[model samples]
Target chain A: MIAELVLAMLFGLLLLGIHRKVIARIQRRPGPPVWQEILHAAKFSFKTTWVPATASGALFAGIVLVAVGIWTAAFFVMMTGGSLLIIFGIYMLHKIVEHAFGLSSGSPYGKFGGVRSVISAASEIPLFVSVAVIGLFTGSLELTEITAWEAVHGPLFFTAFPAVVAMYLVLLSKMPFGPFSIVESKELVSGYKTEHFGAWRAGLEVCNGLKTTVLLATFLLVFAGQLPVLWMVIGMILLTVSLSFACAVTPMLSPFDSVTIQSLVTALMLVYAGIVFTGVLP
Target chain B: MGSLGGIPLYVLEFGDELVYFSPYTITLFLLALTFTLLAIVSRPERQVDVAFGGDAYTTKIISVDEMRFRRFMAIACGLASMGAMVTGDVFNFTLFTAMVGITNVGIVAAVKSPHVQDAAYQYGLVALSATVPLFGAAALYAAATGSLSMIELAKGTLPAVPLVAKALLVIGVVGEGMAPFYAAKAEMFRAPGAPYVIMCSLSSLLIFLRVAEVVMIG
Candidate 1:
């Protein structure tokens, strides 16, 4: 399990590197190398670290561990094909981690970052909606059962298209440069992460990598059903690349606008869910 | 026994209520446990109000009186969340969820910041009103079917729970979670004490997750 987590962290960071690369190429700039993020994490870890005088001592430090810990458990949940509801729960909890990251340091910028994360709770609502829609179509909330249903029938990707779109928007919101990622917007000077530095930042980087892996791989596993490890990795890369292209072409929306768009997508998902509930989507 | 790992680890029955452990609920319960531990061990941070983006921090330490109150509320919130995650009866789940809501508001009540207080006040109103649907849904379930037990409801023997009752349950859970859930609720996080403040959000999200399973299973 440890080895798998380590590999997932490495691979997840590499995907992020690729995300940066894709974004840079699209903008016609020379971005850092694909291994830039790995080096970044290593570089941060070697630096001196300390809790800020004004920060909540234990929380300022402990949130990082919780940040990494939750995502690590999320990775195993996906790996073991646990209930999809557990994954949904963890995904919602990530927002709280962002809130804690921002508020723990008591930095003004961090507080606003945390506040923005809370206001953006609309983004995760569609996650549960998407989960419900999938359960509605497949008649089970178990990941294994959903995959089995897809094996018997074709992928829900064809039958329940809007759930896919909703999940994709969820991925975008969490992605680093995506329009919905107001929490880490540059104006807040790294946003929720502004107060965290050194080994703490490295811990966050590890969490981010695992998060990227679990979310993308979960999306693929759910929609595409079971696959060999290589196929799954390849699919994840493709999905990340596609997300990068979206991030590259678009400018970041204002925070309210970001929420507006996410809310709209959620509404659309609900409409789709309503249609499915009425027996119209089959 | 299966690849999809929601194996039930243990079941404890007390008189008429059952609290069981599955891989999923245990994960949530452990999270509440960890955060409660944090509340017990951590000191509240002094909030730095860089309202002008400069080095101006309020520097006023969170008071001892408030600290004890918040710690108490945080632990209560955590325990309520842990209960909401594991309860086997539908009405028991609703009661635990209501406790989570009250404790969520209580966690923020000691902030002493007018903004946080106002947000908590509004959230309390929503949470209090949410109980109508919450208990109402449970009553509906008991009326429609002869039992309020989730295990019994899941057996496909008694009359299936009405769709309206399930929808009402979801509505109630959404309101209970609305503290960290809505745009205005963000203001409550402005309260100091990240460790304790976090219990408010964590409890809401966990209960919401549990309800998703409740509606799905029962």
Candidate 2:
């Protein structure tokens, strides 16, 4: 567990630099150098911290720490257990904690962002149910179990093809590409992070990096489990490249009106359920 | 237990020691190259245009109110998708996908017309009509096949009952995809090309769900 945590944090740092570089390349500008992310982290540590007059200082600090700490811890746990259900629950807790911190800041933007986070949380239900269904079919909730089943069963794709498609769609939403990026739009002037600066900002950045790494690792452990270790590493690298490409090509979606998001989610659920029942997936 | 179809649940036998080979590594590298080439060469042009150039058509700046709505939906879609994908459950996967797709289409349609209210009503009706039949078909398929294993049906080696069931499943998948496209068109042509918002949300949901499903189910 200790080894996994260390590895995850290290990988998170590495990916942060990679993410910055990729974003820069995508925007048609020379971004800050690769080592810039590390430098920023170091700079943040030395910077003076501030407390809002209206906020509970110790509580505020604790919230941020708890949010980041819990997420990081969850990542390690996920690596060790390789259980899909447990991992999902931990990540959800992480998200909720982050939102709490945002709300604690007492800023209008933060409050609104927190509300949006709740909405996002609500939308996750169907996808959550879908994955549970997968567990039901495979007769196991452990990541390792699913992988072994796939190896023995010759890929669930042949049987649960629609479920596969649905899974892909869910991935797109979770990583929040394009339209799903409503939570982190620049126009909202940074949304939940509007009031945060200096070290707090830096912490969030690091956490974001960690979040990215965790999601990537989870994706690998879930989908490409049969790949040899080296190939899994390669796949992670490939995923980074793809994410960069997606960030470059896709426009940010607005989150002002959730009706569309809700409708799409509903439609997807019904369709996916229909497919599973019909037995047409192969 | 007696062997079913002459296959054992566990087999533990090795003739050779496990070792990493540099040549095998090179083969993977080569395979990656081929995969990239294929992805680039066979890329669909329509998707590229929609993804990269859709913003150019917009004439008005998005209002703050609109931005808020977009943010709400994006986060909602993103979280929902993430949750479903990670659950690694079949039911959650299907339910989330359909929900995300329908909601996206409805929103797009509602925003696209001079009469937002009318558009929403119409879209809602359409979604209802489209989805109900699909569900019925799927249920029928499930009943006829008498086999609950998705893996077997996907193999295309299922008995007669399952074959018909599988055909219905395909229709349902295609229908879900259509809801978003229709919504996108409504947002683009009727509204102010706000389909990108719906599309992005759907894309995020789709990607997370796909990777998770593949790992868990595949």
Candidate 3:
């Protein structure tokens, strides 16, 4: 568990650096220095914290802590011998708490951010379903069980290719690229994190990095299973690159359409059902 | 695509087998066809002008390129739907369904005029209505079967009474569909494009609830 936690944190920090650099390159501008995110976080951690007059200071801080706490917990859950359901539950709780923290801020931007958070949370379903489907195929949601299944069966994606594709889409929703990135765009001015600064700002950045790292890690665990440690590291690096590229290339799709959501739900459901009927889902 | 995140169970089991389309794929294809046909055939001669009402709002119309992007997304949806059908894995199928649903919502939002908030609202309602009962049925099924494997359920023949129950389940599904429409209409009065964001976010919950039902009931 300790090893996993350490590995997860280290990997997360590395990805943060990679994400910054890659995004910069994509934008065709001199991006922040590779270590800029780390330096910024360090600076903020040392700065004095601020609280708005109308805000619930303690609650605000508490929510941030909870967000980080849950993120950390999710990492451990993934590492430990827990079921997939437990890991997912932890993830959902973390997101909910993060949103609650956003709501604690009194600013209108903060309120809007909170609302966006709710919207983003709602968008998590298809991805969750994808994960659940993978669990079902293995006859166990336990990581170990899944890994063992992978080793013996040689990858569910090969047999259950549709699930693999679905998983990829779910991954997209979780990170929310393209049209799904409605929660954190500049229009909302960082959405929930708008009012945070100094150490709070730093904390959020670190948490965001951690969140991304955790997500990547979860994806790896689900898709790659027990690879050699060297392979794992290399694979993670590649994933970071891919994500950076994804962020760079994909047009940011607006989340302001009801039809977009409906379409996603309907399309995914119909396809899933069709797979079952055609004997592809087992 | 790499195994660093740990291999998914399906990957471990199947290992690069060619995925095939199934009934779910057909449904998505049909839906996509219907939508495309609607877009092509029902190109309204006069686009509705955005009339600012209630609170003052700023709205930006999506560009033609964005419309193309929606079509690209639709293609992705169709492909995902086909893939899910081929896999015969319930979890994958459900996930792809949700993605396609969300993508469709995005496409509709992009094409429709801001004045047509009612259309958006109706879309949301349909999503909610469709999802609720689908999930409810899944949950009931999971509980009755003592397993969450959708494949198992798919293979097992259902009793006639249960089939009726499942048919009646459409009511809740329809309610799921109606939810976004109402939500879209409500948001139009506040933020002009609020429905899009709300629907995107809701997609996650809707899919989650449905899967939870399947896991619990199936």
Candidate 4:
């Protein structure tokens, strides 16, 4: 279990690093190596660390543990093939964690980032509906059962294409420079993360890595069914590259527009779910 | 999902009130407990408000009275969410969910800022209206199924839970604190107390997850 977590952290950071490299190439800029984020976590860990006097010291510090702890739990949930509801719940809770990160420090920029994270809550709603769609199709909500169902009935991507698209959009929202990622847009100066530094920031990085890994692997497992470890890694990279391409080509939406587009996608998905639930499309 | 590990076992029960903690609820319960514990022991952060286009900034300190009240509300919100996470009856879930809504509004209602107060008032109105559908769904479940027990409902032996009731449950939850109505919620988060304000969001998310599992299984 420990090895799996460590591997997830490292590989997730590598995927994030490659994501930057891909976007840079698309934009005709040289990007840092794929190890940059790993190095970033290390460098931040070694830097001098102190809690800001203006900050709520305990929450400002403790929120980082909550952030990492929830994601670690999410990692374990996926590892055990428990339930998609738990995984998505933890992901949505991260929004609150982001808000806490910003508010705990009491920084205006961080506050704006945190507020944007709250607005971005629409992004995660689609994942719940995706879970609903998958459950409707597969007759089960556990990953183990879902994969087994897929093995017997072919991939859910074919049967539940709208859900696949919704899940893909959910993935895109979390990509660093995506049009939907207004929370981390350049104006906020690292957004919710601006207040965290040193070890705290390192912990956040670790959480992000684990989150990216869990989400990517989940999409792969749910939509494509089970695969060998090597194939799973390859699939995750391909998925990350596609998300990177989307992030690189489009400019970040204004916060209002970002929320608007996500809400619209959610509406579309809801309509699709309604149709499926009512036997209109089945 | 409907059921973790595709099994059901009530961990504890007393009379009509009981608790069931699937692997799913266990995580949520732990998370709520963790946040509540933080609220109990931590001091509120002094918020830093910056003057745009300049380096000047000032820290806003929370007063003792405000801290005490908001801490109580936050802990109440956390405990309510924990109840929503593990309760065995549909009505109990709704009751816990409604309690969470009330406490969420209370969490920021003490702030001196008119902005947060105004947001809290509006959110309170929405939350008040939400309980209409929330209690209605719970009542509808008992009427249609002849029992409020989730274990009975999940057995698939009771008259199939009405799709309208399920939809109503989701609607009630979304009304409590989902993103579409998050304009007010975002404003509420603008209040200075970090540990307390976050409980509002965490509780809603937990309740939503639990209800998702509830509706799916029923």
Chain A superposition TM-score per model: 0.97, 0.83, 0.87, 0.97
TM-score of 2: 0.53
Q: Write the per-residue lDDT of candidate 1 for residues A175-269, one digit (tens) a residue.
A: 99888878989999989889899999999999999999999999988889998999999999999999999999999999889888888887888
Candidate 4 local lDDT, A1-282, one digit each (tens): 999999999999999999999999999999999899999999999988889887888888999999999999999989988788778888888888888888788778788888888878755665568788888788788989999999999999899999999889888988888888878778889898897999999999999899999999999999999999999999999999999999999998998888778778788888988888888323
Q: Whose DockQ is higher: candidate 1's or candidate 4's?
A: 4
Candidate 2: regions farther than 4 A off: A156-178, A256-259, A277-282, B1-218
Ranking by DockQ: 4, 1, 3, 2
- What tens digits encode model 3's per-residue C-alpha lDDT throughout B85-204? 334344354445555455645545555466544565566556655655555654554455553344444434532125433443434433433323243343421222222222232333
Classified by CAPRI criteria, candidate 1 counts as medium
List, residue by residue over B1-218, the lDDT tens digit for candidate 1: 11222766887888768887888888888888888888788888877875466755466578899999999999888888889987878999999999998998898867888888888899899999999999999999999998887777777788878889999998898888778766745668767788887888788878877887788665
Off by over 4 Å in 1: A280-282, B1-5, B51-55
The whole-model lDDT of each prediction reads 0.85, 0.48, 0.51, 0.85
Q: Return the lDDT, model 1, position A64.
A: 94
TM-score of chain B of 2: 0.47
Candidate 4, RMSD to the unseen true structure: 1.8
Deviation of model 3 at A187, angstroms? 1.7
Give the DockQ (C-alpha) for candidate 1: 0.62
Q: Where does the lowest 10-residue lDDT sum fall in candidate 4 chain B?
A: B1-10
Kindly report the interface RMSD of candidate 3, rounded to 1 decimal.
16.7
Model 1, residue A78: distance off in Å is 1.7
